[model samples]
Target: MKIIVTPSQPYSDQKPGTSGLRKKVKIFQQEHYLENFVQSLFDTLVVPNDAVLVVGGDGRYHNRQAIQTIISMAAANGFTRVLIGQGGILSTPAASHVIRKYKTFGGMVLSASHNQGGIHGDFGIKYNIGNGGPAPEKITDEVFAKSKVIAEYKISDLPLVDIDTIGETQFAGAVSDQTFTVQVIDAVQDYADLMQSLFDFKAIRQLLASGFEMKFDAMHAVTGPYAKEIFVNRLGASTDSLMNCEPSEDFGGGHPDPNLTYAEELVKIMFAGENALDFGAASDGDGDRNMILGQNFFVTPSDSLAVLAANATLVPAYKNGIAGVARSMPTSGAVDRVAAKLNIPSFETPTGWKFFGNLMDAGQVTLCGEESFGTSSSHVREKDGLWAVLFWLNVIAVKQMSVEAILKAHWLEYGRNVYSRHDYEAIPTEAANSVIAHIKSQFSSLPGQVFGSYTVKLCDDFSYHDPIDGSVSNNQGIRVLFTDGSRIVFRLSGTGTEGATLRIYLEAYEPDSAKHHLDAQVALAEMIRIALQISQLVEKTGRVAPTVIT
Candidate 1:
């Protein structure tokens, strides 16, 4: 009934990155490749024999097959129950809610997360803790270590499970009298319930009832069904408000990243001038990333975090006032000002969501976000796209104002931070590292030096000492702060699947409301030039311009 097979050699390259082990579908389809990694994850966890293993994915090309394999292996490895999303569809946030709701022994999520999805595109698998958040770096390290020395994997010879049907199916287990059970759940209910509890749905419905126009682009990815269920069915929005609300295995041959580059269709519709909708939003693959747009205007992720922080009391979940806030290092400091005004602690962690785990667990922060089109409160562990959309809608509903009007009022009250990030993707790893090293080496001599209009006020390699667990992470990034409150940071991205990605972040504060209307690129043009000269990015990577800008 159980098949225990030894892998001839360990997989040296199975190290999990910031998210998970992502690779081409071909890599996962190789004989015993998926099994080896799954076994390694199981071996790293202290799962009980009768524990339930929640399994699901974004419904990508390899998601169904991967789920079947995971179910079989779960049975062989001692799990007595598995609860999965129907049709192998589960957004990242929904999967997190499921795990926490069921109190399972963690869970596995199959997703590449905003990456392209096809035969040659990327696929991924990650383990989530019982708190509905990603496993901390400590657990991921153990899983990666096990992957290097894994010798064998266990799997059952059970037939492929039918994930489409929404009910329970039982099978014989290891013992003669034992039977394992699999439950297929409605993917949208639990998370929608969470949203309902957090916001004033009646207000949102009333706003929608008043003939407001909004468009939600799901990008042919996992959020389609969930968005349709919540926005159209639950709210009073018309059917036409949803775009590409269908889950496709290859995401219709498109990258599902909800950015200006990937969600061009939504961008076009939202910025269509006189014909533009009142509001526009898009969610990335697996539904953890989001892009919010007002009529003919884009809301940068940094501003979104700050705006949410400034007005968090408007939402029901945060009406009692938020405890604190945390953000990635490269994210703009707008929220920091909000925290200061509230007299609450604001933490600056490294570029990964896992870094916020300790802070959140210690109840030091109520909201957290990143510059990468991601935002979330303490509602769920991972950055949630739909939850963010609802928050915006709730704000608009209660304020009875346009998205742009809200932004203007907020900026007028609390100065604006013009922020942008440039990404050099798929460069040589050696070259990317060189750029970081070059910038870091300049830190010692950068202080008191002048670069064009900016005089260096401080220079250092950013290091974070966890207040909750007392762990230290060093060399997270290189930050150069000017005397005038402007900043430039350089770091190599950990979420890339290719050679390497170098990220340069630019931010400059503008206290005068009159100057708030200046273009972001125009305002930071000098800082951008100085950053290039300081890091020698163009010479090192031979990239005259960034592959993407956000």
Candidate 2:
């Protein structure tokens, strides 16, 4: 095949956010748009000799075409081998595992990650380093800089390889002496094996056999096959326990976020009157986020991390002990309490997985999570939805208790951290900025003020100082702390493709065991009102109520 050099213009909007470069499918379909960004990323990397590349996606619209384009470009860019998942499908965590298990130089994960999928929906691509973690800020910044000035891109005039079969295909590269190979492998097997090695699968199987009913919803995206392989084929869960397990290009015309508002079908069944299953869980598009429930009881992401840390030794992987723990800045202090009780260090960082990557690589933390339903340990870089669910199952099997029982006991031991997040989505950019500005303007005078039953203790924009690399990330979010340990946070979410997303996080500590059963929204109603009033969010955005509350 011959190498083709095509001239292209730079697109200033190619800069990646906290995750990756996400945009509408139509934007990616523009002439040389996707090629420009991919080539820019390649140009910033120093390809090692005989280096391999892992490539796959969440099976969304344009995934197959994008994989083909990336493969052809990899050949032209001197990659000796490319290992893609069968049928161009790989959950985000599964992709991370494949990159590490194969010891590839790097990998390209194609996903919008919980975003809607369709011709008019979102598409995204991000490169992960060899350590199976998202690329750090230095690499992402360099790629963005390269994208701004890119003038041309290179591709090989090679036919698309068969990605549906589990086999290897070889073809001559642009250079006569170079040969490029493509291997299509079963995406679920390696990840399942990894899970088996880490957890006590036998105990989990026995628990299921002993009438511990459960339900798992894949949201019609990636992780359907992986969940089936682990929960059904390996753990003996019946087929009826699975929901929306078939992968769909458009996610069955539903938003693929695993939240109360988006995963309504699963939530309804899990919260059914007296007929609910023992345990219920759902994973989002690309399979990186999870929502866990148990017989009408919902576990907040903050409490989930704390509970996992408190009982981590019950699971085989963490039986010995844990090194340390970490959580995002906006996350409640529940995990910190667990870390304190365990005599382990706990870190608070900004809202990206890359920060946790640095700490994990340095061995400073064994488990880390964010408040947005994302959780994982050092087993792999990205958050694993199925892995978290399996961890909970393993813990349940060992403890021989229901999910609600475990949570109540946990709250009784360590004070409950009542928490909720309210999201105002699709707000105009100018209005969102105004809301943030309104909050920041009051930071000087807001301290020492009294609002209802709470008195302000501090106010500032959240910032993170990386312990491993000594890098500083400033202006992460706005925080208003009250004297009673109850606080509120305001942030502009970077994951959405439409207008800006304003997220308000509310948290209040309750040490009384009797009050642990109170609804989170009810417990923090005063703080939520104060948060909105402090930021003037409703007045500026004209949104009387948030788009979603969780």
Candidate topping lDDT: 2
Best candidate, TM-score: 2
lDDT by residue (103-152, candidate 2, tens digit) is: 99989999999999988899999999999999988899999999999999
**TM-score, per-candidate, Cα-based:** 0.98, 0.99
Model 1 RMSD to the real structure? Answer: 1.3
lDDT of each: 0.89, 0.93
Displacement of residue 173 (Cα, Å) in model 1 is 1.3
Query: Model 1 lDDT vs. the true structure?
Result: 0.89
- Model 1 TM-score on a 0 to 1 scale: 0.98
Residues 1-550, candidate 1: write the lDDT tens digits: 5555655457888888788888889988888899999998988896687899889999889999999999999988889999999999999989888988888888899999998898888899999888888887788889889988887888888888899999999998778988899999997888888889999899999988898999999999999988988888889789999999899999989989998888999999998999999999999989999999999999999999998998899999999999899999999999999899999999999887778767877788999999999999887789899999999999999888898898889889889999999988999999988888888787788899988778999988899888888888888888899999899998887776889988899999999999888878899899899989999989988999988889
Clashes of 2: 0
Model 2 residue 281 CA deviation in Å:
0.3
Query: Per-prediction count of colliding residue pairs?
Result: 0, 0
